[model samples]
Target: MDIDLKELNLDELKSLQKQVVKAIGDFEQRKRDEALNAAKAIASEHGYNLEDLMGDGPTKKSKSKAAPKYAHRENPALSWTGRGRKPAWVIEHLESGKSLDELLIK
Candidate 1:
């Protein structure tokens, strides 16, 4: 309420600063908990719990790694998913008048 910051020594000021930071963090956490509780109450009134509404639904699909569809001619270990920009080996293969089908892992 009435803190005379000017009267505080260096250590006291540092301690006060730490206390202020902790207080701010605690206040924010309390606010977030309040909001979450309000949201859960609203969700329950709508015949659903918060978790079901936020569950891993189709809209929250996780990305899976694309299987490599193409490989290096000389080094089979080097591969590409045929998704993003072509790798150097793929570029070189194309530059040599070779088709991407030539690198197919099949």
Candidate 2:
């Protein structure tokens, strides 16, 4: 419809702006609902459920790459195996200023 913009004041213009934003939001919500309904209908026609379609399937394991369980565990290659605090031999070598790499097993 044709309207005279000159007759509207700043307050009216602000109100119109708010109304336009609200209308756009409502339209987007309606569109999303329509799309969801269409998807549901398609899923039903195909005998597939939404939950199953979106859920983790039998072959789909977790996407997360878990950290190695024993990554932080003691290095088995070390002489002491690093199970506890440094062993007596390790301490002795350290006190002598000897490198553990030279003394300890590789």
Candidate 3:
């Protein structure tokens, strides 16, 4: 469609800008829905359910901290998850000829 842009004033231009933005958003949603529906139809024809075909599957990984696998015998508050490098106290204890097994939290 051909239109005269120069004839429109500021208010009309602003309104047209909003309409264009809304139209673009609506167009994108329509296209996404169309593609998803087509994919679901094809999956069903192949005897697969939609979730079996395209779902992300599984909940996100938990954020909870792992149980402390090691701790200082002298200070129960000092602990380590046993994942990263050994802490300074742990290193010193090991250097003193005491086995790491002795520092196990359990």
Candidate 4:
């Protein structure tokens, strides 16, 4: 479509620009949706889902919750898996000249 930019006022130009940006974004999204749908259909035909074929998709496997390796001496409810940064309780225990082995969930 031919559009004479020189003929359009400032407001009209701004409106046109907004419309063009929206149209471009919508076009890209539509293309992605179409491609995904097509891929899903193809995967279905092969007795598999799009996620099953693409292991990194929305239905990808997630790491199971790690079991707690240690628990609070006073309150057994407070526990840690010994994975990431130590919790306040664990830090406090260590600060009080206590060993991490003391917190081990026997």
Q: What local distance difference test score does each model get?
A: 0.93, 0.68, 0.90, 0.94
Q: Which candidate is the best by lDDT?
A: 4
Off by over 4 Å in 4: 56-106
lDDT of 3 by residue, 1-106 (tens): 8768899999999999999999999999999999999988998899987875555644467789889999999899999999889999999999999999999976
What TM-score quantifies how close candidate 2 is to the native fold?
0.51
Task: Report lDDT (Cα) of residue 65, candidate 2.
Answer: 52
Error of 3 at 77 (Å): 33
Q: Each prediction's TM-score against the native?
A: 0.52, 0.51, 0.53, 0.52
lDDT of 1 by residue, 38-83 (tens): 9999999999878879984445568999999999978989999999
Which stretch of 10 consecutive residues in model 4 shows the poorest summed lDDT?
A: 52-61
After superposition, the stretches of candidate 2 with alpha carbons farther than 4 Å from their true spots are 56-106
Candidate 2 lDDT score relative to the true structure: 0.68
Model 4 accuracy (lDDT, Cα): 0.94
Query: For model 2, what is the alpha-carbon lDDT of residue 28?
Result: 100
Candidate 1 lDDT score at position 51: 82
Question: What lDDT score goes with residue 3 in model 2?
Answer: 60
Total backbone collisions for each predicted model: 0, 0, 0, 0
Candidate 3 stretches with Cα past 4 Å from truth are 55-106
For model 2, how does the per-residue alpha-carbon lDDT over 1-106 read when each residue is reduced to its tens digit?
7767789999998998899899999999999999988988898899987667877445556666533222111454434444557766568667888666655342
